[model samples]
Target: MEPYKYCDNRSHHEDSPSTKVEPTDCPKPVIIGLYGLPGSGKTARLAELKAELSNDEFAFYDGSAVIAAVTPGGLKALQNLTEEVKNNYRERAIAKIKQECYNTGKTAIVAGHFMFWPEDDENGWSVCTPGDLDTYTHILYLDVPAELIAKYRLNDNKRSRPNVSAPHLAKWQAFEKNELRHLCRHHDILFTLLSPPLASVSKVGFLIRDFRTHSEAYNKNAAERKMLEILAAGSGNVETVIVLDADKTLAQEDSGVLFWEHIRALSGAAEDSGPLKALFSSPLGYSYIAFRQATLLYEEVAENAEFEAYCQAVALKIRMHRDIVNLLHLVRGTRHVRAVVVTCGIRSVWEKVLEKEGLSSTVKVIGGGRLDDGLVVTPSVKAELANYLRIARNLYVFAFGDSPLDLEMLKAADQAVVVTGEEKTRSKSMEKKLAEEIGKNGFHPRQTVLPAFATPRMDTTRLPLVRLTDQNFLASVFARYKNLYVLHATDRPAAKLLMTPMRDASISGSALRKVHARAGFYLATELCTQIIGVEAYPVPHVQGHQADGYRLLHEEATLIVPLMRGGEPMAFGVNDAFPLAMFHHAKVPCDLQHEHLEDTATIILVDSVVNTGKSILQFVQHIRSLNATICIVVVAGVIHSQTISTSRIARALGRFDGLSFVALRLSDNQFTGRGTTDTGNRLFNSVHMA
Candidate 1:
């Protein structure tokens, strides 16, 4: 079980520890709280992370040690203290950690607890300190199976333990995590769950290292110095650089616009408020020159609490362009593309936005007009910023933006792009200026028009908006994204090359279907086994506690959906391999009754052959409609490779999340299955009738 980062929206929401602090420009104190249930290996994980992060970059702390340092007599003295006294000591310990992290400028990873749950209790009470809740910015829970936790507790020689069942421990872990997630939400803490990794799982050390690296960009001088340090350490192989515009480019709405709108909404009752209202109505409000004035005035007039709340609210709502994010991810994946987000919006707000996306650690957010801002990014200065990345860093600059403000930066870039939104909802002024700039220059800078809606989860399209219903923006981007490694869109010819010999006119009846179906199942199961990997089984065994089950970690919930008739044979073979999987036979697209799909995590759609790939495409769409997060895999003995690569099926497959395909061979056959070549006819012994 690899450590999984929780999605931005949690099952629980609250406002507790984080409601008090203003979004400060001060070097954010990095305190990562390592939490878990008793016997859940919190100490072991802490030690491992500490050993891995042993450097000037990170500082390690033990909760008990902090308590001991402050309270004197440590655990011995604390034992005599009342629960209230103990909690006070815990708060003091957290304060000490905060000071150390702030002073040393090192990330602190502390081992702590959320609550103490005893056996036989239905609900455990939260013992988390207010200081702990407020100070720690990130919380990672060591999520282990209840049976394993029970086993570890029983095996422990550390202390006398109460008797508990696997179910009891499981319930306890669930309660703790639920309560902790709610607490983190209220406190504005980033909460994630990490399962104990199998031997094959990759290390989560990079997540920590990346997070540590991201926190430094808050300070401009420090961030600049670090960038220089990277250059000094890195090879001079970075030839291309991407310069990004913040507001309407990286994010959907302009941050400034969103902030002002939020303020107006907040002051709805006091709409007659003059000072803020006057700044907006005055000529200064419309110009970039007045940003500093407005912000400075805002600091004086707006309640610190209200302003900070709005910042948080706006930051959370700052919808990142998925296409752009995918582009960044593609760049990051290569590990060489130089990309920086240069914004004229509040640097802090953009920083918060980037941080929420888990990119602040790696991507630099440069801009500001606020009090603590060291470098401001505006239209006039954007070119200078591009020049620095191009000239000083000696990297080819590629600029992406959405407005006239980005004209200078775009002109300065080696390869410039104007990222536009659909005409209906996108900033028309920005789009108009971008079109004018392109016409004025007559250069080949790309204009990537994204989705019309602001909602990030909208299934509109992951690619740029194509305006026309026919063109797929995602596919178009792939065609242009030369760095992208895409499959040679036509697999049918290749599938034919491999499968033609296996399927001849002479090869008819169940023998042909069985051979093809078995081959499909073989390839499908192999892929499934590799991807979803096995987890530890606590069942009694003679050899060892672990087994190479050759099954998905989520084997029970893995659903095998077979297109009826021709698909059943291959699905049966797949079923033989993944015996724990639930089998659902579908005769048509509508036959995919999704009522039983709520608990399903993975759907394996099986067919003996895919000529046009229509059925497979339909099933994929139906499954995605039921559960957007479900992993869909298509298995076929032979798919017309050309159809998979060139058709809408290929494009559709690319858009869905976690969707995959496996085929024994790619076929070049364009013939419809009517006679001996018909897969369903052969399987049904209808070849004689043909």
Candidate 2:
């Protein structure tokens, strides 16, 4: 392992300019410096890379050849010149390569040396110039075995080389590797140490492609697109989304810490061999380049299968905070709510943890581990995802996170919760920043301490304490954020239009039934269309030309299942609004068979009133059991307010996939009447007999 340079300045959030030391514009032309000891086959590997990569996309060069070409008397006279003059030539060589790459808009791969340590010298002096540090976007070092390097030098006949012992060469290689790595991090250049057998030409080719395409904007856009896909895949009724950070926020244990410990144990490395701690402490900090370097560190330590195994082992060892786990369970069962774990840590590991908890289906994950996972989830990406969910997807977002790395994301959310773990394991570094955010910035976040005894961040006054276990808080969240459409207390003309006849005490029998049925038509056309969304299709215009027309999405595939008796009138109204839809009378859950759901894309369940929500829950659960993904919307004339927060229907909304509710009004009166007051009795004019 290379020794990392500890720097005082560390920026946890790349989006915050005040935290950065001196950030550079990313997506600069990639110039990769292929480096190794004198006899470590860099030239041979460069030639192989040249053949493997496309000439149009990449430009290859020999460092010494470029230096000689730019020099007056080539290598012969340059060797006799002073060290300063030789350094100037080296600078010119890199500058020329950078310029060529800039002009061509192609990546440049060049075989270069960091420093040369002769056997007679006590210590090696670095040959790296300022120009070299500024020009090279990435440095891939060939850490070939010292013995192999010595053997290769002995076998070579093209040029005479100085003889050196394996031990001396090994020391030289280590020194150069450590120094170059430190310099690269300070200069914001990506550095990866590659070993033989695994560091083949194909591996180098993949790295080049990743470097070429991984611009900051590209990464943010890719993350947004991925988040959009997740949202699009969800039930059409999702109104609220909770964005969570995995490491300390979801669990007290940090997966990144556990991952490094696992790597150390597996490799039998020293106790201080926590590469992540050192990497983040370096000048690169938490910038994109820093995370990219961290990815390379993992790649260096383990192969694909071994890396995956390590991640799984670490995931199994992680114990989620009981509070967070309970919160997720509630979120899973709540209607119109979805949770997504957006982690800067390993996505594979968090995914495994969620799967182990059996919350994987309900909670989605957007993260990265290996290079192939698409894009790295940085602080900016996390904030952007939160913003996207709120603005583009029109969702109420609640974000939970722990560190300064999460501040930007918290700011982007509508409601932010700062999770505080145990003193020893928590992010102590976040305290100052959290204070600044609450005091200086206009950001307000509630603090939740795990274990119920762990000291809260600051105090209840500065960072108000919130208990995830609080029933009132959860209920309030459900009531306010739920994808609910109700006409109660509304001043809208349509709400008044539908509720006037339904609320009239003098109206009863066929006259009242007509009003309830009309209310159903109003809810379906006005509210349901907005809930499920509309799709455009071709239609004939008045001029006999084809034009675009809109109707409910999957209108032909929609099935209206009305509970018999009271639900029949409203069901007919719904069917009237969607004339092309199929109507089925379902008195019980079993009435709708698998065939009914097989061709159904949307299921609209109509009822006159939802008293306890027990029947609605049963039907929704049954529909889910038959088809786990069908979109179900419950349309009713009146739903009791308490039923939405505490009833079985409310709970099932959280558990079942793709369910929503639309009601003419929400009644506070939990009145279940019989005889003359019964909805069915009044609708059918049987109240006279009662």
Name the best candidate (by lDDT).
2
lDDT of 2 at 576: 86
Residue 618 C-alpha lDDT in model 1: 52
* Tens-digit lDDT track of model 1 for 380-406: 567776766666665556688777778
Residue-level lDDT of model 2, residues 481-595, one tens digit each, is: 3333333324568877778887776778788878887888888988899878899999999999999998889999999988978998888888888988999998766577778
Clashing pairs in 2: 332-654, 333-654, 333-655, 334-654, 335-653, 335-654
TM-scores of all candidate predictions against the true structure: 0.35, 0.67
Q: Which residue segments of model 1 deviate by more than 4 Å?
A: 1-29, 49-59, 72-83, 101-106, 178-190, 196-211, 216-690
Each model's C-alpha lDDT?
0.63, 0.80
The TM-score, computed over Cα atoms with residue i paired to residue i, of candidate 2 is 0.67
TM-score of 1: 0.35
Deviation of model 2 at 324, angstroms? 1.6
Instruction: State the lDDT at 514 in candidate 2.
Output: 84
